[model samples]
Target: MAEMIVLKGLIKRFGDLLAVDDISLDVKRGEVLGFLGPNGAGKSTTMKMIAGFLTPTAGTATVCGHEVTEQPVEVKKRIGYLPEGAPTYGDMTPATFLDFIAEIRGFTGTERTKRVDAVVETVDIKEVLCQRIETLSKGFKRRVGLAQSMLHDPEVLILDEPTDGLDPNQKHHVRNLIRDMAANKAIIISTHILEEVEAVCSRAVVIGHGRLLADGTAEDLMARLPYHNAVAVRVTQDNLSIVQEGLSALGPVEAVAEAGGLTRLRVAADDGKARLADVAGLIQDKGLAVREVFVERGRMDDAFRDITKGETMESLHQGDGNA
Candidate 1:
């Protein structure tokens, strides 16, 4: 199942508005790809196209060598999709719901019971298995959705906000589940949660304005941060000017927020890799008494905003000009 998921110049439009635009990517088995973007950035729409729920306006998507439009059933059979909101049959219990799903997927007898039990335990939904879905809490409902998605053990998983309603313990459990299954499946998780991408996904694909903005390992995306791997130095208020001036010779120095009798500054690395010893040496060379000096890891939250926000602003400007 290597390269099980592929998208080539995929585009989706709802009338005059373009939802996904010219996005091309491939997901290999053993790779957990984080589908990241702000709301309405077309993450769901693109996933839908690949899942064969929505046909693309142009281009194509394929799952396991089956072009979605040409072989829709083949594609669906290989995919385990948990759409947003985790919609379920309000009248049915989780037990019945999963049984129905197992039957639909052609599992029967002891094998069907075995699969249902496995996913129910995996998702920690034993207590709520017989409760009507509409009567369950949001978290329970979501877990039921997850259980159904995995009951068939599909080769590819397209999870949209899989942990949206779970508590911390449940979230942790599900993250572990995803990691455990990642070795044999091509998984694409669409979530606004940045930490999930770091913890679960092996690589990340960021989309903005319906375009593929960045695609790389989680660390690679974090490197896009302006202060990624920059050195942070804290000096007394009196030494702030002297310290920043000395550090600027090494690279750009970012002025950090001032605090009580102290000022922290970040020395930007010219090549995005700054060492702590470099900053330490500078402080020592000046014989300055600095309270703290350390290297700052790239902040993922800031990087996400910068990537998506910058493109959104740019697109707005372009629209304004056209108008």
Candidate 2:
């Protein structure tokens, strides 16, 4: 796949504070990269630089072979960007707003009309087309913003919280639209919603404290979690200790706790190769009555919290040591 977006040692500063700290990454065509971070973690700042909305304090960003600072117009022409909050003209209707965007993009006459109509249909904003932007619900307003960004049908899409304020069905529709467009475009979506990354992104990038933390496929990131290859063993109280010892004897058992009115024993493997057969065999060997047994799947929410929390704690510890 062709590299559509590239960042080299990207840095952004606000007064003395470094909002983005020497970050570098590549987004390729046919890939939907999820830019993830806690609030104020430089996700928006980096996207702004890439979209040519903010100039970098140091380093550079390029979209579609055009440097952002040097070729802002060219970069803008090839990228569709939905900024945070999806800001729009409160006085203009959705149709008029999209028409204005189409005109700004240099489309005119039948071409401009066609583009505006197509995006309005694609984003499903027809219901609210004539409503004032400020009068529309948050979801409808967001769709209007989306329609504007997609009006040009650019090769790259930079969306910050694209599905914010959207209902479940709307969110699903937007995710599907992103997937459909992923075949030919390089897309970057910044969102705090972990489920969105799992559902739509081909790769996930995590940042915190203005620094890159981790980058990989959703499943790849989840595999870094401690829960990876962990299995939950539930048994009767009479067999709690017996099951714990039985599973522990097989390898290493992580923890034993109470959950869902049963004793839950969590067993883990260093390599994610823990087998259910071995665990069931141990139960049979020990003559223990197993109430329920299942392998724990890695969860995005758990992985996101753990990664960000651990990084924050580690950074604080380092700061204290320096002090």
Per-residue lDDT tens digits of candidate 1, residues 206-268? 788798777788897776676788888888877888888888777778877666877778887
**Residue lDDT tens for model 2, 206-293:** 8887887777888877776677777788877777777777788877776555756577777785477667788888777778778888
Which is the leading candidate under TM-score? 2
Worst 10 residues of 1 by lDDT: 314-323
Give the least accurate 10-residue stretch of model 2, judged by summed lDDT. 314-323
Clashing residue pairs in all predictions, respectively, total 0, 0
Models 1 onward score TM values of: 0.90, 0.91
